[model samples]
Target: MVAGATSQASAALRTYPIAPGVSVNVRSGPGTHFSIVRTLVAGASVPIYCQCPGETVSGTYGTTNLWDNIANGQFVSDAYVHTGSDGYVAPQCS
Candidate 1:
């Protein structure tokens, strides 16, 4: 029962698609000045755990200062993610 509940909750988390044909850089922090921790695979979809203001970037989605937190210490520019919204899609990072 507990496992089923956990699965349901995990499944409820929404994943947003990355820009097609682009392998986005995952940064340790919300800005480009932060070290690149990894590169997302092309066509990857990510669950935004939170969001925060960051360096303004221009990408397939246009320019924005929003950064999506996909994991602890892992962030990607929202400009490269297609969240279908021009604004915040998740809670702001604390």
Candidate 2:
């Protein structure tokens, strides 16, 4: 499990890192900041249960994508999903 956060399975998670070099962003308030999750890299798949579609959006509901919190084996959004030939997280787990 990740440090500061826990698995968001309880939440309606989404998929992220659908590709590489995409760099899924960890924002300070759902959007903006563009701070990396630190745990995820290109290809790292995460389940986004709580999504905040856009940075300017006011609420988390009515979000388009399935957003996951990669604090514990999770992912935020596909914004950083890999765009490589394979499109998957590297050094995969078991």
Candidate 3:
């Protein structure tokens, strides 16, 4: 390999896949009560910057209270993300 390629590969690995066939809502906060900031296209993959506890949700994965912070002010239910962990996959959001 090439320089920095390993890091790039590791970064790619950090991204988790969204649930199949669903256009998931990206909320401003970690709960359904939060306003919708945007919606993700089906088959979207997102890199989780952090995670936080919020309202529990059930989706293609399983029910959980953990929310994955994909970007600043953007969060999605962990139940919709395939992170291969039932718990926190990134640092806790502050």
Candidate 4:
């Protein structure tokens, strides 16, 4: 069975890349200082369970205070992610 399969299935919020051809780093935390857990390809869609404020990042879309929770303990800067809004589109991470 896949890890976090139930949670993944239940996640309704999705975010896409804001910049074309540029892969975004998925980190253990919400900042660039954190260790990179993986990389999400540009134009790839990721399920965002929630958001939280972290290191500010400026990207092609704009600056944002939100970081996307793409998986269990996995975060990516919201600045590079197009969530269809500038504000929090999902619940705040706990």
Q: What does each candidate score in C-alpha RMSD?
A: 3.3, 11.8, 2.6, 5.6
lDDT (10s digit) by residue, model 4, range 1-94: 6975666445564455546777999999988899999988877877778889999888877887578988998998888777788888788998
lDDT by residue (1-94, candidate 2, tens digit) is: 4675655453334444444554445543344445554544555676443333334321222323323344453335434542232222322222
Which digits, one per residue and each the tens of the lDDT, describe model 1 over residues 40-89? 98899999988999899999999999999999899999999999998998
The lDDT of each candidate is 0.92, 0.40, 0.91, 0.81
Q: Best lDDT goes to which candidate? A: 1
Residue 24 CA error for candidate 2 (Å)?
2.6
Cα TM-score per model: 0.87, 0.38, 0.87, 0.80
Off by over 4 Å in 2: 1-16, 34-39, 56-78, 81-94
lDDT of 4 at 42: 75
- Stretches of candidate 4 off by over 4 Å are 1-18
On lDDT, who's better, 2 or 3?
A: 3
- Model 4 TM: 0.80
lDDT of 3 at 54: 98
